[model samples]
Target: MDTMTYDYTEPVLSPKGQKMRDILADYITVVSHRLPDDVTKKLVELSKIEVDPLQRLIYDTMMENQMLAGKLKRPSCQDTGALQFFIKCGAKFPLLSELNAILKDAVYRATKQAPLRHNAVQTFDEFNTGMNIGDGIPSVFMQIVDDSADIEMYVYMAGGGCTLPGEAKVLMPGEGYEGVVRFVMDRMTSYGINACPPLLVGVGVGTSAETAALNSKLALMRRVDSVSPNKNAAKLEHLLEDGINHIGLGPQGFGGKASVMGVNVINTARHPSAIGVGVSTGCWSHRRGKINFDSDLNYDLPLNEGVEL
Candidate 1:
């Protein structure tokens, strides 16, 4: 059988644009190998809390996995997942026009350099793109900031297992915030195990299902130990974290003292008639990174300390 290749034309970029693309590609590869600082810290904290022999063993193995992955400069998980970028770009940024093309090219480069799994399949076409650059494969969600010349981005690898538990729904207004809690708890009990337990749960509350879903994903980009700024939302974060931990899914769903590293809540105002809630989870691997760049292309990676790209 002849090997099939998806045709994707590379965009011609300016010198600066090419530089940015290469930097992003290197960043992606680094993100693939090393868990972010917050995630690593949380895992270590959780490991000490588990007493069951098998549970402790699982945590030990997880630590070993990270050490080996970093030492060998290889991906920690076989499933590298589809790449997603949540970007906050300034209106005055120099590369704004070329940002999209640069990002797509960067993913293509990372696919080869990281040896990431062939996860981008065309819908209805039923074949892998091979390059990991298919129609909207590296999903980019951007928010524009006025009067600045810098950009901040969150790069996430949304693997299948972690994404399996994601869901959103709109509840009647009368159901109240308590209803949001009920909805999240229900999902956590039913499907959180499949996401590889000791998960990082993200809850989004907004005006509609779509808004809530987007907020839920944004929630996942936050630091594992961070709490919501809104006082009520912060309270709810603790509430949901305690509620999910009570499930006792433990390390890899094997049953133990803790089922979650943390729960983050991101909320926006909603209409009077309805309440929308969405839930998303990050597995124990939790491969996500944050990078910031100035107009001159100087960059800083706050999530993975000591990583140079």
Candidate 2:
């Protein structure tokens, strides 16, 4: 793949646009250090369920690590991962014209200010960009809406352990949805623990492999407490969660009662001839956050309510 061909445009920002970039830098810093509310709450719940003495100790250490990261203002993990942004914005957004530039600068500034580990290495050259900006770095996926002025953004760090190489396949018409379950089980049992277990599994079912792969990652942006709104999808979520947890991968894959915080499935109507299924996982640390901005750029960090910046 020629990463240079990725359509990431850079534009000069106005004074107001510069300010938005600064705010986004701050948002990245906060997200990098603080676990989002839903993820934190789920971690607490899982900690209580863990009965193994070693696993209980592991949870305690995990909480301590999170607390110290926030208190000291540092990344929760050394890897810090690759920056990925999922954005849904109105075409009328105040910053729509400058959104891409702002996001790119946000990553650059966050890399320096947050002191995030430089993880963007030139694929063929194997040379680190050091600034966290390079060809295709800080990937931004956008969905444009009309007749509104709000923007919703999801920020995720594709850590070394999490963001595992996802699996996707198109099942034949006769295979049926049961094949989807079987595929997920195969992947989860084989590699889910390797992603630093107590994972959040995101499964996507759609008409084709590409759509399934995209939806799988998007599902990771949802609140950990949320289940699929679709009845069958919700049931699959429960069954997958139950089945994976029964494997005893536990916190950090050290072995315990719970292997995953939750399993979420996002689906679209598939073609009559095929069912495409994909799976992705988030590690226990789960460094992801969601925020909403109004026309004026005044933002609401629903996942970080008490966070001022």
Best by lDDT: 1
Scored by lDDT, model 2 comes in at 0.88
RMSD of 1: 1.2
TM-score of each: 0.98, 0.95
lDDT tens digits by residue: candidate 1, 96-210:
9999999999999999998788899988777899988899989999999777999999999999999999999999999999999999999999999999878999999999999
Question: What local distance difference test score does each model get?
Answer: 0.93, 0.88
lDDT of 2 at 219: 88
